[model samples]
Target: MKIQLLVLFLSTVISAFKITDGTLKSSKQELGFFESDSLRLNSTEENLSVSFKIKSNTKPNQIFVKLTNENGIESSFKPTTKKSGESYISKLSLPFTKLPTLFQASSKLFVSLVIASEEDKYFETVGSIENTPYLISKSTYKPTEKFQAKPEIHHIFNEAPQTVDPSIAVVFSFLSIMTFFTLIVSWGFNGALNFGNFKFDLSHFAFIALIIGYEVTFFFYYLGDSIFTTIGRVAILTGPTVWFGSRLLNYLGELRVAGQR
Candidate 1:
């Protein structure tokens, strides 16, 4: 009778072990509960406190708490656990700096408790706490003032482009005029201004007019006309200027030759 009882006791213990082991291996088994009230914010240590429980039958090789911010940033934390009667209580102090910096007081973070079991080759997400408020005191941010007309934005535009000083402009203009007159006087003294060989014809006047037109074109270019436009105008005048200038020079050459003879 004593030997029979001993064998039955051994069989009962073996069956219990098999059942517990099977439960640990099964992914469908419910893990445990999370105490939301157990969540704490430690400002001094700069860490967040989180607590959760796991089944007593299983001893997990690792336990992790994952936090996901609104922006999809994820952070994982490993917790130190303690063994309770029917469950293992796990708590972790995650550094606040480890969380996503964009987290605000109004922001919600998805919390997940994951466990890796020695009996199982894969990790399992057992429990989750959804829409956990970002509880850190510093998470509160000052919003912009609302419902009031904003201060009129006085745009500080850049000043308009300035030209040379009036005095300097005047001085340069006087110098240029004096240079022009000096050049004419020098030409007259050198007999270069003599119009004896000059012909009062359409070609001569046209050549002179084209030369003045070139000066006018340059003046307009300096006053902000597009370089392409100036170039186009100059090109149109080039053919006429060339023809008239060639004819005037040939006529002068003939006149000079005749005078020399």
Candidate 2:
């Protein structure tokens, strides 16, 4: 019996050394989330009770419990702590309602201890406990339960645009053509086609080209192009057209004033 006790003592010392890098250092510190059935789950109260132990020289300032499920949901809570001789005992009561809704039997519970030494602050993870069997069996509701297939969706689209009567379109086209010809005839009779007073320079030529481009852009706009496209094109031409048109008008006015003089 003495030999057996000595062997057990050597095994415990070996295990402790292995955990602390083969050193008999009591300053290495130790922490544990469970020790011989320290965890309790109250089904009626819907609360989980956890007791963890930490052995450290420095007094801890805070104790936290972290719960994580297989679905990756996590929850954290602060626990109460009490000094037990040379070590500290921290206990937490976590409510089911306070935990993540997806937490299940496959969830894990982790405990952490935080210590502050002068200006230095550090935290240590005690350990993790997994395979919470009572989480599902004791629960009345399943928050992570799957549902059946969803209802089919039907889409509604706008009706296609209707076309105008071919006869009416033809009549309108004829009237448009006649009005264009009539305007040209009136302009010609009024000598509007005469460019004798206009300058034979870059400004005059650019002004005429820009005017024709502006008119053609509107004609295409009436034909099929979207309003936004036409507006963007018009905006591009507006600045240059205004500059050249202004120069042409001033030159023409100067020429008229010189003739009057």
Candidate 3:
């Protein structure tokens, strides 16, 4: 007996509630609620139609449909049923000519359904499914403009390359020969006298200074715009400059020893 009663109670609960369905269609899909479009506004009267379907097991005493804006202003419509049963179709028309103040601003619109019975009241909120319509006195956007391009330019020749300079190459070749001759002289003098004193002189300092200046200037020019360029130029220049500078120092030592003798 209790199982039968439970089944009957569950059936009655399910039968009491209803599901509402909504679909949006319009003469113009891209039309903004507040923007002027191909759809002609009758200053005398403007109408918007919303159609919906309601499915319920039991009959409702009153059905109320309302449209609300973003500002919470509501426009109410009481639908009169044309057909019997749970399915329904209704039209709502808003007259702008009668209430010009309502159309003054761009506003969002929402649709809600309210059903009332002797024992229960059911409320369902529907729409706002469309984009907020813009209200404009005039269209302000124009369609003609071109875009511009800016490119970065680098001066390649004005800045030294990441390789050794030809002028420095000649200087380095002279320095290498001078070093070999000086080493030969030092070995000869030490073998004969059994004692040798080698000293670096002013000419050696001048050679080193010139190489240093060249290196510094080369790096500064290479780094004109990029750090990677500076590092590469420095590495290339430093190797040759050190090799030649050491050779120039040894040659100066040989010169000083000959002068002392």
Candidate 4:
């Protein structure tokens, strides 16, 4: 009787791990997507790879892969399966050049995998391992070492100016012109022609001096060598000067108008 019991226990253990029943299997845990760029020109023509696995008795009938951005633009890859007995591998070749135009710095790409026809469908996200909520880089392409640097001109000024708001521009232009004319009338050209006994004060002289200094610094900052560094230094020194000068001039003009009345 004891021998029979031992035999039964062994049989149960063996059946628990029996491969023929397809119970000892692995499910598709996750997917991986990667890219290779040959030219490395920051263009989209790189090679991409997507990998996934299945560990159940059921085989996936179809798989779909897609790349999308925050703007809802999408690119799809249709995979062809190659079977080696019970194991299957599906692959798709995608060109980066064909990616959506909306894919930009602020955009994201989603790589989703679907195992169609499975009673319990499996889904997984595959892409950059950075764990960022957004996909900022391409994963389906490899970068090549061709070393095509972006033109300096493009970085400097190639980007289109943001669409101007006509109303805002018109308002600002009118204000700037009005302020300029008011300053000229209040101070007079070189303070030589005064409308009344209102002589120019030290504050008025200081305001004019600072404004001239700011304009000179701004011009030099733009036209000088090491423009970025020069601009940084000039802005720090001149920004407050210009702000104070403008405010003082406006305040004095207001006082003059009040006195006139």
Candidate 5:
């Protein structure tokens, strides 16, 4: 029995706890809707862990942690701490199930701190000193109860997002290539910086405008949260073109006037 106990002790896993190296934040979620706002406990080391501690001037007799999951399930925990000042502080250890699930449909994790603010040092039932809820991560947590799937989580993000307008991409690429060539060509005729010559000035401005136009369109289309309508996209594209085109025409008129002079 002693030898077996020795072997078990040697085989036991010990977590290497360290202070946070980076800003404490939760892991990325496969589901877009859920995000974690839970105060971080420990560094994100080999083992998953998180904790929260709060200090204030007010000392309350008691402090409590309230957690809510996507299913609207709620649970409360009392933190262990010694009074530092006027406020009672609660330090906490987080469980996995109280966090948002990776593949699960639940939207977010919420946690709040409840404290007593009354002169009697008794916590009020309503509007008791409560902290804003936190969002939790389920990456390392497991719940006592099995999680059931919600249809909406799967259904809403399931449909494939529409592909970006190919024509827009082609046009953007073409404009970039043309802008490069135009700069090279314009720079050849009128040195790299030639403000006196309106033609070269227009070429420079046109290149900048064209690049901006493409970037704005791509930014909107590529963003996951934003839905870029075809009309909205087309509208954004038109701005730079009109601006660049007008500059070109103005440059020509300037050249004609200079030639006459």
Candidate 6:
């Protein structure tokens, strides 16, 4: 009789529970309950809380709860005990920063738990994060205000080649300023410069156009998300820089020849 009773007791003890259903809610709304082995989390502007309920089983203290990702990353937490009517549940805030960066912003995360009162060992479960809404992805961003949503733009650049350095912008600006001053000095020498008998002031217009083109091209291309942007940046900047440099040299040569004559 003792042996039979012991076998029955062991059989009745649920060695583990399968994560059956999950519910998520934000401050404004319930995102809707989902049936999943893994909890889908979203990185949204709203604070999200998710709770997972197990199959019909006697609820224990659930003294230990830790979440792990596919990468073996882990975060341990103690959920506040609660009963929703008759059902037992444990709640974990989604995208928990409470623990060491529990899940990467948009990657799949696995879960692990142990009811210390019921068992001594922690075991892995099918439970995982399903979605990350506020995950800082490029697909779901809108720039409403004056480039207010810069992070979305920045994320695009992160996936691409390095942007133009600050030094490049500084160098270009200096070159533009110096070029304008040199043009003024050259105009004083030539009494208004001309090109090929067109009798138009090419110096002023060409210098301003090249400078504007250089700044605008590099600014956007540096923030772009393409391999070609990097390659094209070199080609683009070369055109304006070479044009300005050669034009300045040609102007100086003309003044020198006129002085010799």
Tell me the TM-score of model 4: 0.32
Each model's RMSD to truth, in Å?
A: 18.6, 20.9, 18.3, 25.8, 29.6, 23.6
Candidate 2: tens digits of C-alpha lDDT, residues 215-235: 999999999999999999999
TM-score of each: 0.35, 0.31, 0.34, 0.32, 0.25, 0.33
| lDDT score for residue 138 of model 1 | 61
On the 0 to 100 scale, the lDDT of residue 51 in model 2 is 60
Candidate 1: deviation at residue 200, Å?
1.8
Off by over 4 Å in 3: 1-15, 30-46, 57-59, 95-100, 129-261
Displacement of the residue 11 alpha carbon in candidate 4, Å: 40
Local accuracy of candidate 4 as per-residue lDDT tens digits, 1-261: 445323322322211111111110112122324222111223333444554444444556656665544444455676775554565566655444455434434233545455555354544334421112233354343434686876666346577778789999999999999998888787775785655645566666666777676677767766764777766766775766777677776776887898852
lDDT of 3 by residue, 36-68 (tens): 232333223344454555465455687776655
- Candidates 1 and 4 compared: the better one by TM-score is 1
The model with the greatest lDDT is 1
- Indicate whether candidate 2 or candidate 5 has the larger TM-score: 2
How does each model score on lDDT?
0.59, 0.57, 0.53, 0.50, 0.45, 0.55
Task: Give the TM-score comparing model 1 with the true structure, all chains together.
Answer: 0.35
For candidate 5, write residues 1-261 as lDDT tens digits.
445323322432231211111122234311111123333322223121223333445455556654544444555677675554443334554444433343122343344334544432322111111112232232444555668864665345577778879999999999999999998999878766645553446555765777776787677677742554735766776777777777777766777887932
Model 6 agreement with the true structure over 1-261: per-residue lDDT tens digits: 445323322332355554435555555445434325444444444454656665434666554455555545456677665666555677766434433443444366444455534542224343455445455352232434774535544334446666799999999999999999999999979877645433255764676676776677767776874758746765866776677768766766776787831
Task: Give the count of colliding residue pairs in each prediction.
Answer: 0, 0, 2, 17, 12, 13
In candidate 5, position 128 carries an lDDT of: 12
TM-score of 6: 0.33
Error of 3 at 125 (Å): 2.2
